[model samples]
Target: MPVPRNSKTTGSKQLRPGKAGAVENARPEKEESCQAKRSPSSPQGAPKKRSAFGDLTNAHKNQAGLRKKDATKAGPRKAQKGTAALGVLKNNEINLKKATRKTPPDEASAEPKLVPKNDPVLEEPAPVQAPAIEDIDKEQLGDAYASAEYAKEIFNYMKEREEKFLLPNYMEKQYDISRDMRAILVDWMVEVQENFELNHETLYLAVKLVDHYLVEVVSMRDKLQLIGSTAILIASKFEERCPPCVDDFLYICDDAYKREELIAMEMSILRTLKFDINIPIPYRFLRRFAKLLPLPWSQCAHASMETLTLARFICEMTLPEYDYVQESASKLAASCLLLALKMKSLGGWSPTLEYYSGYSSHELHPLVKRLNFLLTYQHDDKLKAVRTKYSHRVFFEVAKSAPMDMLKLEVALKS
Candidate 1:
């Protein structure tokens, strides 16, 4: 009466629960068995074994708790973000308010004001004064003549060289032309000068060239007008910015001479002069002397201009007088300027003028008398060109001014 195999299997399966309970009660014994097995395979100093499943379980629990704490902090973080956005908006509003504030128009347009504590109003800076001529330092004044430097030496040398250009003989004796003929030529040249609006320097230079040519080369009296015309043409080319062409010069001369003859005369004059046309004339020295006068600073420019015009008139008068040819241009200029000042009742020649001009009152007095004689007595019908030219108001009516008396001139010169 043995049991069936199937029944036996079912009975063993039912006893498994009891077996599991017993294994649980024998845990220390199982651990000891496992240690024994591990000890055999491991080295003697190996660490004791840990429960890996227990450590994994504790790590999972800690992770879950940390996730809960992060969820709890999320509300406060959102509140802080909202507050920071509000602060940024408030700062933008403040900036807008500052930008909209009104600025005063005057303050906006004006430069930044620098207000002093004692004086609120801004004062203008005082004007600087020029030094008086008497108090001016010689070195600081930088006057080319007063400095007594190389300019003086060069000028003296030039004076010596210019003296060679003077024509000592009569224009009529040198050439076949009379003094009246020379005066007529000069008068025509003046009209030509006025027509061309040429400078005074050009007029003076033309006259000088004509005189020099007459002295050097003897020409027939019939060709005198051609000589004057050619001299003016040469002078125009030398001095003017837009010089009249040969055709224009011919027209001014009423086409008196042919172009070939005029050209031939120009060549002859230039050849005879050796092209030395740089003759010193009184006009330049007159201008320089007028500027050197120590007039009142306020009136210096106007006074100098008036004096210069009168001096120029006087110099032009000297051009027609053959006797004046012996005097140097510098001496004539000094005398003319001195006479002009005396006539205008300005101070006479001073030491300063003497120092700069290298001529004293005594030296210029005789020349002054000679100039006076020419200005007064030499104005006959034939020699009235310069007087008529200077009588116009454009020349400041210099010819009409009372002639300087001899006694008063002497007194002023001595003073």
Candidate 2:
């Protein structure tokens, strides 16, 4: 016979039917009562016992959820570590915030640890570099009208084209028109420019046309006025928004030349120059070089305007003079600006001007001396158009401004 085990349903022991037939001991009543008190009040059956594999699966799911939650908490800490010192400072600020929220309202908040600038753990960041003084065009990059991107290229192209248009002592080739006559014509052209409110570029281009045409074609002295009028007419057409008609130019000449003659002369001038009349003018160059002035002084802005006006007056004086015809427009403009700066007690030729103008102070010294001489003593009493026009208050009376002392100018050149 088989031995019998205790019966869970009856809570009693069962005896084996073999030899001796001993009875099994019964469970204590106290243990039974304890189990009864621990049992659930609902009529649900007991839970099924889980296997080892099932327990492992449940543990893996719980671990996956816990890992996701931990990664969510550490998101900001990873970002803080990526930023180096700035990241550390931000992390400290976050910790201080957390500590403040956790602290009781009655207690004082924890003081934040301030990092010193010279600390090895958190040093100051490197300073940003300053903009170059010579690169003035970069500041105007925001201004569409400035054309800052193309400004350097345009001026460089102009300089290169200047070699092609360089003039020689063309008067030696002319038989009829004299230098004095040319001066008178230029003076009259200036007057016309003032009278008709023509652009300064128009006046300069007109003069260039007259010179270039005079160099190539020799004409009778009476036809000189016709050439001047025709040259200005072409320039007006090239530069003016509403250029004066041929009749208007003929009228300016007191009807000395007929409209047909003026129109013919215009074709002649244009054809002689091959219709490429984009001559670089000293006025344009002077304006460009004058922008290098007013070097960081509070009052230098107004002084720069005066200095520029003085330079302009000096440049205009050379327009009528026959000697300066061989000089390049850029050189003449640079020299005039340098001389003006000296006269105004401003600084000498700086690296910024030299770099932009492409002329050293030594190279400009001779031209500067000659321009100064012209400003002081070479004024033509007969041709007073430039002087009289600049002496007005509108031009800041720069024409009336006295020249610098010769010794002082010499000293400035050396120093």
Clashing pairs in 2: none
TM-score of each: 0.62, 0.67
Model 2 residue 216 distance off true place after TM-score fit, in angstroms = 0.8
Deviating ranges (above 4 Å) for candidate 2: 1-132, 296-299
**Per-residue lDDT tens digits of candidate 1, residues 1-415?**
1122235343322211101001111112222222112113322332233322224357888889999999989989999998987787688997646544655567655545555544534433332232222322233233332332344554566578676876767564654677777777787777666545566667888988988888877777778889888998898778765567787666656557789988988899999999988787776566546656657535455565567678878888877666776678788889998888877778777766776578988899888887777776666685566777778766667888778676766777677
Could you give candidate 2's per-residue lDDT for residues 1-415 as a string of tens digits?
0011122224322211111100111112112122112222322332233322224357888889999999998997887665675656576998757755877555542333453556655543343232334675665565444556677787888888889889878888788878999999898887766555566677888999999988889888899889988888888788765576766676667668787888898889989999999988887677667667756424455555667778878888888888988888899899999898888778888877888888899999999998888877876788988887788766778888888777788999888
- Every candidate's lDDT: 0.66, 0.72
Provide the lDDT at 8 for model 1. 39
Clash pairs (backbone) in predicted model 1: none
Output the worst ten-in-a-row residue range by lDDT, candidate 2: 18-27
